[model samples]
Target chain A: MARTILTALVSAAVMGVGSYAASAATLDDVKAKGFVQCGVNTGLAGFAAPNASGDWSGFDVDYCKAIAAAVFGDATKVKYTPLSAKERFPALQSGEVDVLARNTTWSINRDTALGFNFRPVNYYDGQGFMVRKELDVKSALELSGAAVCVQTGTTTELNLADYFKANNLQYNPVVFEKLEEVNAAYDAGRCDVYTTDQSGLYSLRLTLSKPDDHIVLPEIISKEPLAPAVRQGDDQWFDIVSWVHYALVQAEEFGVTQANVEEMKKSANPDVQRFLGVEADSKIGTDLGLTNEWAVNIVKAVGNYGEVFDRNIGAGSPLKIERGLNALWNKGGLQYAPPVR
Target chain B: MAIGVTNVPERSKSSGSIINDPQVRGIFYQAITIIILAALIYWIVDNTVDNLRRANIASGYDFLRSRAGFDVGQSLISFTSDSTYGRALLVGFINTLLVAITGIITATIIGFLVGIGRLSHNWIIAKLSLAYVEVFRNIPPLLVIFFWYSGVLSILPQARDALALPFDIFLSNRGVAFPRPVAGEGAEYTLLAFIIAIAASVFFTRYARQRQLATGERLPVLWTVLGLIIGLPLITFLVTGAPIGFDVPVAGKFNLTGGSVVGPEFMSLFLALSFYTAAFIAEIVRAGIRGVSKGQTEAAHALGIRPSLTTRLVVVPQAMRIIIPPLTSQYLNLTKNSSLAVAIGYADLVAVGGTILNQTGQSIEVVSIWLIVYLSLSLATSLFMNWYNARMALVER
Candidate 1:
């Protein structure tokens, strides 16, 4: 009986040596550090890249700015952590970044298995192919036996295979890890096609030696729901990040632009009142441990969801991608948000 | 001499004094070390298991069998997107082996020639070798790969305007395309004959060695072996009607079609590794040769031997004793340096494992595989070098 008790105690001691306590809340860490550590892509034009003045601005950058606005009431309080696709997840897991807003795709393996919580997707995207205009290829189906260039270790690579296999088309893929290398390969005429997200195709084509020489194929191969993600464990911070996305969409649904938000706060509409935090009885901001004026800050910093879309990647930017499927629910698109009240 | 007497009795050892004894203390120290190591290993395994379970990632070798769904730029074996991740890694290993072996052969030849050139009487030849070594040896290998990949190969013309070379060869930015030989019926017989010729050459070499020991006269075994090997293979090919054909590359509207091409990725990696490693090897060769005392060559000349014969017969054997150890290190460095294939997309083991790591979210398993494979390759190389060194060291006696 005594030996059995001693063995149990020793085993318990060994168990304590292996498992560790979870990390502190990301919100608390961010607050204590006075800046949000945001993980972003090394450089993808429409998603995340530095400008001439070395300031980061893009769809993903604006989202991180929105997050910062929600927390600190200041959008410029974010310090970006540029990471490659291969190092992104490990960097998050190692606590080198507070939030990952790198236009990362949400998938089952990344969410449940990789110890992450993906907020709602900010962009609805799909895989497509870009080929030289001289090839006279109009559709992806005409790409049989074509040599395709793709980035390795991406959902785009897998989707390319599935699309080809499903269509019973043959292709030879030239894969590279870096976007620059893939672009160079395609530019050097080593491959006939380059496959990636449609928005990416637009952005990448601009960087090509001859942007006018290529055309994107008219095929949307697979769904790529690009979302922001945070590490698991710390449900409150997850709720804050998740609700920040919903608040932006809800503000857009309520027709709350940055310029009109303050004026809209004086209107008699109760839904808009609660959304803008003009109604003092509203608990949405308090529930997330923020001021009732949080949504106003987000809108002022990066505007509502539609405004963000139109400016960064939609009609205003060089990419000029249309907001077809990314429009609000009432306008025949899929973006729907819950009521702030 | 006077005998001395002691009044005190000799001290006897007690159980408490066992720590003072070297043998007993040695055992105690080793026991402590073993226990500590075992504990550390157990702790690490437990931590990894706990982390993996918490993350809900399935841990096992089962992921290797899943669909890779990715493409490699170059593969030695047949592969497609539908191939398994295990097959992808195998392709990567084959590519690495191809580069390492090919680089070693080319580097050795260039290194020996440059080393000999540096020792030449001509001032121009010696200075040129010195310049070659200094230029390559001081620069990073990664930049060298980029220099060849981007600066040289990427600047070549497009496939539609490929620079045509002799014998159905085409050079472009894509690659160098040459006719691929397709074997026909009865090709197996020729391969069998070639194998037989190699076996015969080995036996002939052993026989010549025995004859030399017995009669103190050496046979012309090098020429005999070369003739048997080449002549036997040639005779078989002719007898079999030389049933082979080439699928020559043809210039097309946009591509040079119907032939195999060596991609620029492979060419850049191969060239960079060979040139970079050859520089260090040349220095080692030069030092090894210079380490041999001048007295040995002079002794050979006093025996009325020609200068060329003295350098080959007397100086070379002694220089090899100093060269083998450092030469093994350079060979190993070249093998490890081949992992830089990722920088230019040649898809070596490290690069392939990196892709799998991201795809499967299996960082631990993939990294462990890389560590084990590189360790095994290094050990196997060192083992072979040790065997060769032992054989050479026997000559000293």
Candidate 2:
């Protein structure tokens, strides 16, 4: 009797697998809802943290705002769903959020097996370690026999393990579920080392009680090309999101800013004219199922990618991160965009 | 008078109309109910599976064989990041069992002490126990865990300036590091002697009981049993050469090196679960003792039994019949509450499973495994407690 019931239950569960699976009209859904649902980090200083007034503004938040502007022509036509490291993927998978701009790393396992579509890396980060200056540990190699604090369920945790194992070093891991907990634990002296992306280290350091007391180690253990992700199987949505990133990069390369985007529309440069939809019969935005003014709206809403970075995490911000690999392709960086034509 | 009746009415007889028959109606309604319930369950499962598949989320237990690629804070068995997810989960399971078992033992001891103290004639003792119970019971277990973790343990001094205690132990914010025992050659003989001593003590206990039954005189059974167990192991260790040594922790720049250390995560979770569960267990213990008849204690006193002996030998035995069932519940509660280890990153089953689920995106598979493991743990605890309860139950002639 028990075996029969179990078999029946299993069969019934399998039968339910694809009953409500097909949902490719994310754009339409967003249109109907009148806002883009964006998943972001619960609280990270420069990438995606809310201010005291609960208004989120950061490098990642700009991507979310750009998407909303592309879709609805208004940056504020969006809602933020702050997620933990463990909750990000499920939130995206379950359609609880339209897109995740959560400083999430793009990896093959996540891109393929996890059914996520990641493109156009927004932030090129690498895993690094931070230790108190008093420890006199100038190099990651000296991190052997140290207790490292990290957040659980992140690529950083996996990379830390692989790095230590490859180096044949012994270390203890003190993992927490939330980023804030990791920060607090490390600050409380529960661990000798803190490991995460280098950018995150710099960003989080400012929030530390003694930010100047700690220094990031020089070892870049893993490539963490953090990007915005949407659900897979929606090529239209994928194109829209990936191209939104490209448009921002192209705008930056074309010397557009939030203050000057409208003025640049009258420029005689054919490429700039076509990009800002100044040229008649330009199908760039329409091809992606958006208005011809989509790029203009995006640039107007959040400026270009460099502007977003500078305003949130670069010289204009307290993070003061040097845009080393994040600079434009011609400027010895990796941010390149395909021609709009 | 009833036996004189020529015919007796059938208890389950029906009238001419089948709808009027209660038995038939009951069967008919039950069949419909069963069918409805089965259909509802089938619909729910089918819809959920369909939704998951449509969402492109893979659901299966096959990911267990993959590399965990993550390190746990504490493990009783040998484990590393290279270990498979299955092994990581096993380590987590063992950690859960470790905390639950230790928490249960400590809770019971504290619970019994406090329960008796609550009834103490001394007002100070009674008030203290009451205060302890009320304070713990009123707060949530998660808050208690945070209190110990962030409020207490995190405030400890750093590793480089660790507080050194007696016997080469070190206390720091990282955790308590102590000397770990490493067995040397010939240690097997000492272990063998310990096992043999246990077997001998069992026989000695039987002999003493039988001797008392026959001679109506008691032997010094406690002292003899203790001697057999302790002396045999001590003598064998000296004869075979003391084969156990301590690997004491030495203070280092980063942390204490070369010894066993219990992380603060496990310590906080265990401490929180124990204190929280002990409150409920104390109340159960007090109620059990109170449930025991007053006559039993008075009768023991009349038999010239001392007050302490009367409480232990008479009142307590009867009280246990009332205590064991609820005590089992408290044990199960503590075990389940150990899942809160995730909040503090104690690497218990739920925390480890959560990491795997996130890594693999196998939410359904991981959730099912948790349900099965927790259900099994609860059932096993219930089985053992039921057996113990049976032993303590009254054996009426």
Q: Tell me the tens digit of each residue's lDDT in model 2 across B221-275.
A: 9999899899999999999889899999998778999788988898899899999
Of the true interface contacts, each candidate retains a share of 0.39, 0.58
For residues A1-341, could you state the per-residue lDDT of candidate 1 as single tens digits?
12212222232233243123224467877888888899998788878999999999888999899999999999999999887677676656545677899878899988876778897888999899999999888899888877788887788888988898889977777778778888888997888899999989999998999999999988999999998988777678888888888888998888889899889989899888888887867886877988888999999999999888888888988889998899888998888887676
On a 0 to 1 DockQ scale, where is model 2? 0.45
- Cα lDDT, model 1, residue B353: 82
Candidate with the greatest TM-score versus the true structure: 2
Ten residues in a row with the worst lDDT in model 2 chain B? Answer: B5-14
Every model's DockQ, to 2 decimals? Answer: 0.32, 0.45
Q: Which runs in model 1 stand beyond 4 Å of their true positions? A: A1-24, B1-39, B251-254, B394-396
Report residue B178 deviation for candidate 2 (angstroms): 1.2
Whole-model Cα lDDT per candidate? 0.83, 0.88
Clashing residue pair totals per candidate (backbone < 3 A): 0, 8
Candidate 1 reference-contact recovery: 0.39
What CAPRI-style quality would you assign to candidate 2? acceptable
